[model samples]
Target chain A: MRRPQFSALRERLLRAGVAPRAVRRTIAELEDHFDDVRRELEAGGLDPKDARSQAYARMGSEEAIVASTLARPELMSWARRWPAVAFALLPAPAFAASFVGSIAVIACLGHLAHSWLGVGLGRSPGLQLFSRCFALWILWALPTAAAAVCTYAAWRRRISLLWPAVGIVLVGVLGSLTNFGVQWGTATSRTAISAGIGISTGHLLPPLVRAASTVGLALLIYAGCWLASRRAEEAGSEG
Target chain B: MGDAKALLMSGVPELLILRLLAEREMYGYELARAVRAVTREAISLGEGVLYPALHSLELSGLLRARRRQVGGRTRVYYNVTAKGRRRLEYLTSHWRRIATAVEAALAGPQHA
Candidate 1:
């Protein structure tokens, strides 16, 4: 396959952790510089091929350009670096906390409602399982909704898709891990796995189901949100 | 240039850029050519140094950039800020100090 022109230069700058905006600007400037040189050369009567080669020679080696550019860290300003990293990281904790907190609060409210109706959860295990599963779905759906809104806003602004996508995935991973931890803790304690009052592993399955379903639902929501936002952006741009 | 001269050149570009932009807004190509002309070819900052230096100066709030079409071509023009003027003042004085010291050293009695 034909290689992308300037791929090496792009990779070098990006690998050195240059801001994407700066790299893009640099690329645009390089193109202009080349054009200017080529124009000058062409005016002197050289053909396009010779003019192009001579233009490229005037810019010096790619290595030298990348080195000098990156040598001054301000060219990749911390203003750009920290904000992008922070924005990508912000949603992870928010999503995880929302998922876990939503589940916990919903579970508590469900328990209270059952107790008030004179039918405690443990007395009706099937109802308890259903309520918990519903709670898990809500836990997954709420953050997914919030993420969708964020994705849509970012899409409208033409911000990069990579960071938000990364944030959503990270949020999902973190939420899943927290959900697993809660499930394991609740199962171990409620099952009386210690104090010589062990219960069957089969009985500890509800929380496991809750954990898996919540993560699965979250991933689905994220994927759906990303797709919808991307479609909307494309349609808006085309229109 | 020797290592000593290279070291001095390191900080000189930013000064020259800020000084020139303080006078009037100019684009990358114009600035490069102007720098060469004004320095009588004693200093030649290639695109490599010119652009990154511009970006750095802009990031530092010493310069601001805008895009405008000139002769049917879009060009990014840079202008010095109030802060840039202050920076130029400081750098100019600093350069004068060093140049004066270097000049005195060169004119000192021959050790031989």
Candidate 2:
């Protein structure tokens, strides 16, 4: 399969530290210009290959274009200039906090259900199951809430979801790894985590399997949040 | 264009761009064609100069860009802002002043 011409240009611009959103917009605009020129040339009876070459010639040397764009400091996105700091500052802390907050809420509810309600009132299997499901559902809610916040941040910056998406995945990986570290640290108890699938803490999940599952779950949450934020922003911009 | 003429044309691209965009919203390619046509082929803007100028203009809030789907192609069209129009008027007056001075100098002094 033929790779799109613009893909290589996009990669080069990105490698040169151009902002991701600017790279995308610049590539799209240039591609549109080149295609329009080629179309016009072809209509004048030039062959497709010749027309494309002429179109490129009209656009000027590739190096000059790229260099000029890079020279324009205004076009460089904040994230592009300081990627490490950008990833560290944004969405990561917020995501981690949201995840931790969700876990705390789940724990508090679980305690209330088991001690306050179940023992004091009546031991009900349905209430126990409800508590477990609620905990899992709430755990999933953490990523979604983080996604919404990231999306809003992106909109405010007049940027696309590139950083937000990266932030979500990065924080997700960090969270899962932290969980794995804790599990590894305290491997004595046979804790039964009644996630959608009940896994006994005694026979701890294989490290590989657990990591894969964690990453998978994180991805699922990221995908959901990404879609929600995109849709919401689209609706908001339209309104 | 001579070195002197080229040096003098440094800021003309932005002026011409704002002038063309003042007529109607146009994408880069269309604006480029308009520039050449309206200047009677006296001016030709390379894509490099045009795109960067457009971006900087938009950044400075002198122009607004909107992406539209036209005939299945994504085209970013630019329109001059009120500020852009005022800038264009100022540049136009400035250019006319220089032109009048240069024409008088070229025509030689006449006895008053």
Candidate 3:
């Protein structure tokens, strides 16, 4: 008896916006039920091959199961069911979370290094590099990554592109607010890190440029992913 | 006749599921067997098709599912939630009303 391959069905369910857990459980339950039917038929004097065939009949076609599952709109993933809330309305709070989360992650890593390796907390070249990279991550890479994820998810699920674009722009603006600077301390003072969010009217141009660049980067990533997927599909058809 | 029976079987899986689960918790295979037993093999739905019903019911919060390991095998048990009981009540009443109306219509034509 050949094991049932449900990879195609898994992809279909995912693209249809069924929750990941629901899709997995459905596939698992189907496979398990098939096995039980096969066992039962085998116990009733059928050969293994015949049992397998009977089990397939008894279990019904995957197409039937897929159709039934997809028919229930309530089974769809929450994010897919409400694209605006998941992709647009939530990005603001998510941006704040990412900002604070980034800081927390950096602080945790620094603390680990300090405790584990006896490294001093501040005034080292390592600290400077860490702070700079973290600032860049929060201000640019994080937002780009977030937007790129939303774009990819939407593209994968064949969702409308509007929410993802809005998410990109909103996340980009938030990223621009990740203001950071090196606070130079005098002879009796220590080197300090100054990080604040927001830009004054006098210095708005840089933040605006930062936000625009973040959006550009996210768009570039989306285009690259889209092109790659298209090429793969074309190659598959050709082959 | 077979095609008519098939057509009428729409949503029957859900009804049977909720009705049976309202009595006791059962896994998919157990529920499938119980369905056959209760219907005396009259409603022979492909056993595998029950899962979509079960899953959707659970997803919609009409049923609660929990996984248990028995003899090195995992089985998911499902029970009707309070909401499920209420839904079952509504469905049962609705189904009875439809059945009664159809029965009367079929019988009235014969009497005429």
Candidate 4:
């Protein structure tokens, strides 16, 4: 229909927060359906130009499609429906979950290694190995992951970054409060793993200090990404 | 009057789509053809109404869509889910009741 302006339709649907997959499928199907309809019309003895015009008419107006899609609540994303939850409220929780989940994985791996490889994780070399991984996760991976998730959620939803920025800071501060320690156990205990929450309780600096630094690092990374994207967009427009 | 017609027409595309897919899995073009055939072109839904309704149904867990290669073309086929079947049954009964009531009304006091 009028060449469908399928790209424009795609942009409109995405701008209106229809899921990308649905939008892509819809546009593709519409293009294909138009071709079929035009072919059928031509077969029915209409002129090629008439068939083209009629095919467009049979596809319905673009506004109608957009409106109908908008009316379906389920087609809109969760982030679109609740920007606050997806961008703001979920970051700290997501950080907490990442920290806990990573710790669990490390612990599980230790257990599996001990069981399968006859290595006592409580001993020197084995304990040292898992503990290094644990420290890396707590200090670097978990915090970075949380910040990345928050940034990505905002970017993907095409929502404002104000809440996600707040979310990143909150996650950083809250994530720093947890103290995780792994050490060789006493005679009765195996490899001892401990978790507690307090201000600067672990090997890290004070709570406020670590939070500020972590947030600073995360923001730096995010800023670099934003700058790169902006430059790319500018370059694209220029070309 | 336009609003009323639109309101009445709501759920109609979903019902027809679900009912058709409930019988056989079909891609978008094939399904549209089937709808035209079954309704004798009386209820021809253009891409606007049809695709949106299909997507809504899929998102609501009422329909399942799959992609398959057919004669070198990748066609997406849709089938009604268990949830869609229940939804179809409900819509069918509801439509029949409305049709009966409208018929009775159209037939006037004697029929009532």
**CAPRI level of candidate 2:** acceptable
Q: Tell me how large the interface RMSD of candidate 3 is.
A: 1.1
Per-residue lDDT, model 3, residue B56, is: 82
In candidate 4, which residue pairs clash?
none
The estimated TM-scores of all candidates read: 0.59, 0.61, 0.69, 0.73
lDDT for each candidate structure: 0.65, 0.66, 0.77, 0.76
Candidate 2: misplaced stretches above 4 Å? A1-3, A100-239, B1-9, B97-112
Model 1, range A108-171, lDDT digits (tens) per residue?
Answer: 6544554454433344666556555754564455545545644543443334566666665555
Model 3, residue A100: displacement in angstroms?
4.5
Over the stretch A1-239, how does candidate 2's per-residue lDDT look in tens digits? 21265554555666677666777677777877888899999999999999988898888776757766776788876765664456436766776666566556655655555554444222345655665565444444444455455544443333445665576565544443333101101122221233222344565544334444544554565566557645654554453
Docking class of 4: medium
Which candidate order results from sorting by DockQ in descending order?
4, 3, 2, 1
By TM-score, the best candidate is 4
Q: Candidates ranked by lDDT, best first? A: 3, 4, 2, 1
- Give the alpha carbon lDDT tens digit for every residue of A89-192 in model 3: 77767777877777666656655555565534455676678677777777777777777777776666556668878988888888887775553333344445
Write model 4 residue lDDT over A1-239, tens digit each, in one string.
32334656665777688776677678888887877888999999999999988987888877888988889887787776677787778988877877788778766765565556553446668567768777867966677678777776565445567887888888887877877877654344544567766763465666666677667766776676667645645554453
TM-score of chain B of each: 0.90, 0.92, 0.90, 0.92
Name model 4 segments beyond 4 Å from true.
Answer: A1-7, A17-57, A114-134, A177-189, A194-239, B39-44, B59-61, B82-90, B100-112
Candidate 3 lDDT over residue span B13-83, tens digit each:
98999999999999898899899999999887888779889988987899999999976889999999999
Judge candidate 2 at residue A148 and give its lDDT.
51
